[model samples]
Every structure is written in C-alpha cells, then in structure tokens.
Target: MEKVTREEEIDEIEKIRMTLGAHLEELRRRVVYSIIAIVLCFVFCWFFKVQILDIAKKPHRFAMGKAGLSSELQVLSYQEGFYAYMKLCFITSVFIAYPFVIYQIWQFVRAGLYKKEKKYILLFLPISYLAFVVGGVFGYFLLIPFGLQFLIGILGPGIQPIITMQQYVSFVFMLTVALGLVFQLPLVMLLLSKIGIVSPDKFIAWRKYAILVIFIIAAIVTPPDPFTQTMTAVPMIILYELGILIARPTKKGFILLGTAVGCGAIAVVGVYFYFTHRGGEINVSNPYGDIQILYPGDRGWKKVSGHMSFQKGITLKTGKGGRTVLSTKKGVNVGMDTNTEAHFFDSWKMQLKTGQILISMKESEIPLEVDTPNGRIRMNKGTLNIQAKDIVTIVTAVNGEATLLIEGEEKKLLEGRQHKMSIGGEPVDIGAIINWSEGIVTKSDEQK
Candidate 1:
C-alpha cells in the first residue's frame, strides 16, 4: 500500500512540472513574438522620422507664429537631435506595435480567465486602440497648441522664447502618452464596476472631488494657465461622468439617451458662446501704460490705450508698469495689475490668463463664473481676488459668499476665508482673506 501511494505522488509531481513547463514555454514564445513585432515597427518608423518630426512640430510652429515669435527650434548638443529622432521612432513603433503587444498579452492571460471573461478581449482591444488614438489626436491638435501659446505668451515680451529639439520632442511624447493613458479612464472604470469593485453611486457622489482632482492633474501636467488646464480637464470630466453612466446597471437605454442629450446641450452651449463671443466687442480700460489684446482667430496683437471696445476672445496683456481695468456692459468689473493677461469669455464667464484680477460683481439673477488654473468659482454679488501663478491659484473671498466648484463638488467660502489651491494637491487654508485683499478695491455695498 505504501509503495502504491509513493508511485501516485511521483506521478502527480511529474504532471505539475509538465504543466508549469508548458506555461513557461508559452510565455517565452509570446514575449519573443512581441519583441520581434516591436523591432520591425521601430525599423519602419525610423525610415519616416523626418515626416513624423515635421508633423510633431506643427503645433509649436503655429503657437510661435501666433505669439509673434520665431518659428525656429534649436538643438543644444551635437547628438541631441539624433537622440530625439530615435526617441520619436521608438514611440511611433510602440504605437504601431500596440495591437500585437496587446494580442500577445491577451494570449498569455486568456487561459487564466473564465471562458466568458475571455470574450471581453475581443471587445477591449479595438476600443483601447481607438481611445489611445483619440487621446493622441487631442493632445496634438488642442492641448499642445494651447499650452505652448500660454507658456510663451506669459513671458511678457521680456524674453525671446526658443525651444530645443530634444525638449520639444520629449514634451510631445510625454503629453501624448499621458493623454493616451488618461483616455482609458472610462474603460478602466467600466471594468472595475463590472467586477463589483466600483459602483455608479459611488462615482456620482465623488464627482465634485473627481473634477477637482482632474483640474489639479491638468495644472500639474500642462502650463499654468486657465485655458490650457481647462482644455485638458473638461474632456476628462466628461469622460469621468460617462464612466459613471456606464457603471450604472439599470435603465441602460435611458442613461444613454440622457448622456447624449446632456452632451449635445453642452456642445450647443459651447458653440454658441464661442461664436457669439468670438471677436465680439469688449471694453478695455488701461489705467497706465499700453495694453495688448490678442483677438480671437487672429495671430497678431493689437495695441490699446485708454478706453477701447475690442472684440471678445481677445487676451488683454498688460505691459510692464501697466494697470488696466476691464468692464463689460453686463456689469462685470475686472481690475488688472501690471503684466497681467486676461481673457473675457463672456459677461458670465471670464478666465484670468495670468497675474492677479480683482473681480467685483453686483447681485443678479445669474451668477458670475471665474475660471482659474485650479478650479472654477461661481458667485453672485461677491468680491474675490484671483491670482494665477506657476502651478498655484490663490483665491480670497473678501466679502460675500462664494462657492468653489472642483470635480463637481462645491465648497462654500465665507467672506473672510481664503483658499490657496495648487495643481497637485487639495486646497489649503492660508489665513484670513483680509490679509490678501486688504488694500484691493471691491464693489460697494450697493452693488451687493
């Protein structure tokens, strides 16, 4: 009996070893194939490095032209350009070989998942690829241009902006890859929700915090400007909300309809605001020195002195030792200090392009919205001091109550509270609001 038991144990051990060996062989084979595919793609992309590089430089050139700066990009080292070219080819190869890599990964893991779960691979692969491509296109077309323009424009004409080939390529690669990963937010959430790891209700409840986090991420990743941060954050917020919609298990049809309608309404509103406000009249008053306005759909800057009504969507840039006051007919007052850049989206919405702006508004049926790099503030009959600097936004509610909306959540600020919000972290209380807004002028009591 003992001999029979020993033989059986030996046979079991042999079977287990064989299975492990087979799995190892399979993994090795898949890895080799993936490597071969990547190498082949790399060689192919290397041949078209010139064309790829040129395509990547388009946004930089466009931004430079818009800023009235030179279109030339420099190379600091002898091997810098060559290394950049290699980096470009490597990234392009990864993109081209992504499908094969995903396939190999799926093959290696397919046996571990249930038969029902395995079927999801077919659905996930193509959608994942499409998401990456969409994100890459967005980064290239919108994010890069807006980021470059804001960063360059903020120099205040004191410095000539010149970028290096290596730096620019590195920036492009990071932005595209980061956005590609970010675009996976919806898919990841759906997967987690399906697995019972996350639920729709939880996401909905966390929406406000999520939006705040998204803006913080945008501020950390992109340039320190409201426009650039907004361009990056809005899409992420939309995707996050969509993820919540997908996570819900009931009323799929209704949810889809509601999402579509909501999206359409937002699109319509955005388009209406963009077209009507684009090049519409704005009143600019310079208290001292000259003010330059970069009009919408125009690359060049227009000089303005004293009171002038220029088109909306124009960025008001104040010269050194210059102070400007801007007001719309709709009762919005903006006081800009020297070297400040501001953009009036409309009477209801305005963005502090750069520097500090003292905003005072009268009590009205509609609340005024001010967008900063950190988040958005909505208020009625309030005085708020908003300042945007590198990676930080300081907001002080001098008087009246104001709501700071981030990630869909609203935090109410009292008259004397000051909030200092940064890109990579939560808002911190930095003492009393009076300390920051003491001498600054605001609307009178009658205005409130």
Candidate 2:
C-alpha cells in the first residue's frame, strides 16, 4: 500500500508540472501579442504625430491665453525632434494595449483561482484602466498648468524666456503616468481586501501612515511650489478617505460616482483658479542677474536682486561676469540680484498672479506678435487683445515705426514716432518676468 501511494504522489507532481508548462506557454503567447500591438499602435501614432503633440501642448496653450500670447517654441535637435509625439504615442500605446495585456495576465493566473474569483480579476481589468486614465486627465487638466504658470511668471524682465520640448514632454509624461497609477488605489485596495490579504479595519487603523505617504507622494509628483503641492496633497488625502469609506460598504456602484462628482467639483474649481491666476514659470540661469522695478508711470529703471535656480534651459555661454548657464533636469533655485530697468518685462509676467496683466503701451512703436495669425506683427497699443497663443511674435521698437519682419514680408507694425517714458524706480512685480537667456534680451538700461 505504501509503494502504491508513493507512485500516485509522483503522478500528481508530474501533472502539476504539465499545468505549469501550459500556463507558461500562454504567458509567452500573450507577451508576444502585447508587443506586437504596442508596435502597431506606435507606428500608427507616428502618422498623426503632429496632432498628438498639439494635444500635449494644450496646458501651455491654455496658460498663454490669458495674456493673448502664443509661443513658437522650437526644438533644437533633428533626430530627437517631434519628441512630444513620440511620448504621446508611447503613452497612448500602453493604455491602448493594457486591456489585452491584462487579459493575458489574468489568463496566466486564472487557472489558480477558483471559478468564483475569476470574474473579479477579469472585471478589474477595465476598472484599473479607467481609474488611471481619469487620474491622468485630472492632473494634466488641473494641476500642471497652474504650477507651471506660477513658477514661470515669477521670473521677470531682462530675461528672455526660452523652454525646450524635452523638459515639457518629460513633465507631461511623468505627471500623467504617476497620477493615473495613483488613482487606482481604491480598486487595488478592494482587490486585496476581497482576497483577505488586507482588512479595511487595518487600513483605517493605519490611516495616519497613509497620510504621510500621500504628502510625500504629493511633494514628489507636484512641481516645487508649496501651493501646488498642498493642493495635490489635499485631494489625495480626500481620495484616500473616500477609498476608506467605500472600502467598508455594500455593493453601491453609486459610491464611485459620488466620489467622482466631488473630485470633479474640486478639479473644476482648481482649473478656474489656475487659469485665472497662474501664467507660466521662468527658467533662469544667469550669473550676473539683476531685477528691475517699472511702474505704469515712472522714469528710469532700478536694480533689485532675485533668487532663482533653474527649471530648465541653461546655456554654455559665459555671462559678462563669466557664469555657467546651467540646465535643470528637475529644477533648481539660484539666488541673484536684478536691477530696476527690467520692470516692464517683470510686470508683464507678474500681472497673471493677481489676475489680469494690465500695462499701458502708451505712444510707442513696440513690435507685437499675435498667435491668431502668421506674420501678424503690429505696433501694439490700445488695450491690446490677449489670449492663449495670441502673442507669438516679439515686440521690438523702442523707437518709431516698429517694423515686423515675419515670413520675409516686413510689415510696418506701429509707426515708430513716439518714445514712451521709462518708469524709473517703479515697484518690481516680484512674480513677473524674471528670466536670463542670451540674445533674446537686449541689455536693460538699468543693468548698465
């Protein structure tokens, strides 16, 4: 009898190996399918690459609208050009192929689950996908724009602001993926709960720890502004609470809807504030930096100092004082002083923080670039219309007849006939135009 039992045990072991082999084969097949699908999607995305990039730029576009401005931001590399589209394609493909990938994952594990539990795993596929996409949208739509605007607007005049596509794309990618994954907390916790691996009671008990984690996560994910970080943390905390609340309850699908509605309301308010206030952050990398204070009605410029590190874009060119123009992969803060002649530029960026940027152009021929049309340069004056992408050209006419040379055809924008008085010793707009790039800015009288 003992011999017979041993033989039977060996047979059972062999059968288990066979089952494992079958499952492994299925996993391999699924992986191949996923790879193929991703490749196909990426190729397809490459076709409509421009469109994808346009979508990625919407946040910046929205922020620029307040000043009736548009930017013709350029990418420096040839091979790495069209980077935004590449990022969009990659991200979109992951999402597009997720359902199939999840199905494959489920198939690999389903044999181990009892018939009763298999459906839950299958259902989780869509839930996880939806939650992530929603989170990504929320972040892109609400938080990123405001954070960018606040930081950029703070860098005021004597600095010609320039941003690269690489940094922007990376930012969008990180935020979208991070937020999408985070938003899946409830579903993930629910699954663990149903499996008896995690108890709702225990989760509630350890809520404080969770809050700390949320704060840390908020800091990691949001831009380095306390305001933006706090805003994100509050929502995440609220979401955690909602997850806890729902973790205990009956089969109420409406719970998610209610939670979503509340989240939506908060997001709406956040969006409104972001648009109404924040404009864009500045990237400054200057050694000999100075600030300027220009009032609506003043005479000359003053030199005030500033504190900025770098969000992005540092050149190799030595300053007149010979300083390194550093670039930031994340962003760094450096401290410097700026003189007062830069007030006009600074004030332009600062007006966004308070709401609208109001500066009377007076009787002068300043070059103006409008995003609404190509080569639409003008001697901008009289309550100049502003909107997202409205101002893309440079306004350059300290003297009479601001000649706009766009698209090979120079249009005499505003006839250069009058010189507007320089507002000297005007209070500097702290959160306005403070950036330092080579060439884009002519030396301010105050800097001299």
Candidate 3:
C-alpha cells in the first residue's frame, strides 16, 4: 500500500508539471502573434510617417501660436529626427494593433475561465479598446493643447521657447499612452469587485480617499498646474461614479442602475440648459488705477475701489491704464484690461463695450456669455482674450473652446486660434493681418 501511494503522488506531480508547461507554451504562442501584429502595424505606420508627424505637430503649433511665437520644432542632432520618427511610428503601431493584442490575451485567458466568465472577458475586449481610444482622443484634443498653452504662457514675454523634436515626441507619446491606460479605471474597479477583491460598499466608503488619490494622479500625469490637473480630475471622478454604478451583484441589477443613471443625466442636462438663460449677480474687486461703476438708474458713474457687488444692468468702466478683476460666487474670474468698458447682464454674461478683457473659467464649468459689437462669444471653460474695438471684436481662444455667433451662424473658435469679425456680424479672415508665427527664433538663429 505504501509503494502504491508513493507512485500515485509521483504521477500527480508529473501531470501538474505537464499542465504548467502547456500553459507556458500557449502563452509563448500568443506573444508571438501579438508581436507579429505589432510589426505589421509598425510597417504600415512607417509608410505614413510624414502625415503622422504633421498630426502630432498640430498641438505644438497651436501652443506656440498662442504664446505668440514660432511653431517650428528643432532638431538638436541629426539622429534626433530619426529616433523621433521611430518612436512615433512605434507608438502609433501599438495603438493600431492594440485590439489584436487584446484579442490574443483574451484567447490565452479564456481557457481558464468558466463559460459565463468567458463571456464577460470577451465583452470587455472591445470596450477596453474603445475606452483607450476615448482617453487618447481626450488627451490629444483638449489636455495636450491646453496644458502646453498654460506651460508656454507662463514663460512670459521675452523668454524664448526652444522645444526639440525628440523631447516633444517623447512627451506627447508618454502623455497619450498614460491617459489611455488611466482611462481603464472604471473597468479595473468593476473587475476588482467581480473577483471579490473589493466590494461596492468598500468603494463607497473609500470615496473621499479615492478622490484625493485621483487628483494626485491627475497632477502626476498632467502639466504642473491646477487648471490642467483639475481638468483631468473631473473626468476621473465621473469614471469612478460609473464604476460604482456598474458594480452591482448581477447583470440585471447593473442594467436597472444604468437606466436610472441615464434618466438622471438627462434631467441634469435639462436643468443646466434652463439655467443657461437665467442671470445672477457678480462681485468686482482688485481695482487698479481709475475704475468707475454705474448702477441701474444711477445719475453718474461713481469712482470707487474695493469689493463691490453689481446686479443686472450695472456697467463698469475703466479709465486710462486702469484694470480690475471680476469674480463670481461660482469661481469665475474676468480681468478687465486698460481703458475697458463692460456691462453686466448677469453673473455669467457680460458685454464688452470697448477695450479688452481676459476671462479665465478654469475653476468654473458654467458657461459665460460675452456680447460684443461684432458677435457673441460663449465659453463654458477656458481662458479667453477679447478685444472690442469700435468696428470689430477680436476674440482669441487662449486655451479653451468658444463659439462665435455671427448673424445666427455659429463658428467654433478653438484654442490658440483668433477670430476677428466686423460689426456687420460677418466672419472676417485675419490671416493676412496677423502673423501667428512671428518673432520666434530657434537656437541656431539666436546664435547667428
């Protein structure tokens, strides 16, 4: 009996070793397939390297333009361009081949999962890819442009920006990839809950800490500014909420929860739209030089300094070399430039009668409406510089998106772009008047 028992134990150990070996072999084969897919994608991307480079340079160009500098990137060394191209192509290839790689991963792991669990994994594969693409697009369209603009804008006047190709490529690639990976937050949370590693109740209890950690992660991943970090953190918070909603005990429960959330969201949007047409009071402070205020039905403009609150129909005018900052209860800031005159229709809406004003909506998500002689400027978030002249209004989207309504037609004004329209409400092209890349010099040019 002892001899038989010993033989049985040896046979069991051998079978275990054989199973492990087979799994390893399968993993190796999957890895090879993924590598082949990546290689093919790399070759395809390399063929369109120039077009890819152009697409990559758009944000950099916009940033430089906003900074009132040239948009050309430098090549510090001859090999720098080569390496940059290689890195760009490789990153692009990875994004293109990501789905196939995920499919291979699913194939390798499916054998270990039960039939029901395998369905979940398969369903997640495409969704995972979609989330990654959404993250990448968010970074490319909003975060990258605005972050670069803020960083460049802070360098101030007279300091020349010397960005190199290799450095820029590396920065862009790292940021894009990091955002793509981080956007898997909700899916990761759901997975943890499903595997019993974390419960939904635990996630709810840890909400405050999760928020703190989310902001910290945003700071690490984004440019070192409160504006950019907050911009990144807001979406992350929403994703966390989504994770909680999807972490129900059963699929049916999740579906019911999703339906409720969808209805809630629609109601929220309706409420927001209704509030957009309403008005509120605003606080004006930090007056420098000569600042005058005219209240509703006032006989004369009163010259005053210090904090003051104004209701609807109040007008504020600044004299020569005068400036002041306006703030709202919701944390919107608008800086009135020298010799400016603005009339308040509401807390979120103002009319720039003349001169210039700089609006910063970084802390506020509420939309601000500025009515000028030329057109109407509507911005929900970002920094905007508006100069109102006698016959024209010049609006520059310093780091956010705005819409310019000209004669009932709305044209979107994007970051780093300027829109100049005449009093007739016609969109006037000013490409001939403003040289966006003026006064910018490279290191080589500076040396010369």
Which structure among the candidates has the greatest TM-score? 2
Candidate that scores best on lDDT: 3
Model 2: lDDT of residue 69: 34
Alpha-carbon runs more than 4 Å astray in model 3: 1-18, 249-448
**Residue lDDT tens for model 2, 273-304:** 65674432333344453333222222444432
Query: Lowest summed lDDT over 10 consecutive residues: which window, candidate 3?
Result: 271-280
lDDT ranking, high to low:
3, 1, 2
By the lDDT metric, which is better: model 1 or model 3? 3
Overall local distance difference test of candidate 3: 0.79
- Which ten residues in a row are the worst by lDDT in model 2? 349-358
Candidate 1 segments exceeding 4 Å error: 1-21, 249-448
What does candidate 1 score on TM?
A: 0.54
lDDT of 1 at 228: 70
Regarding TM-score, does 1 or 2 come out ahead? 2
Count: clashes, candidate 3? 0
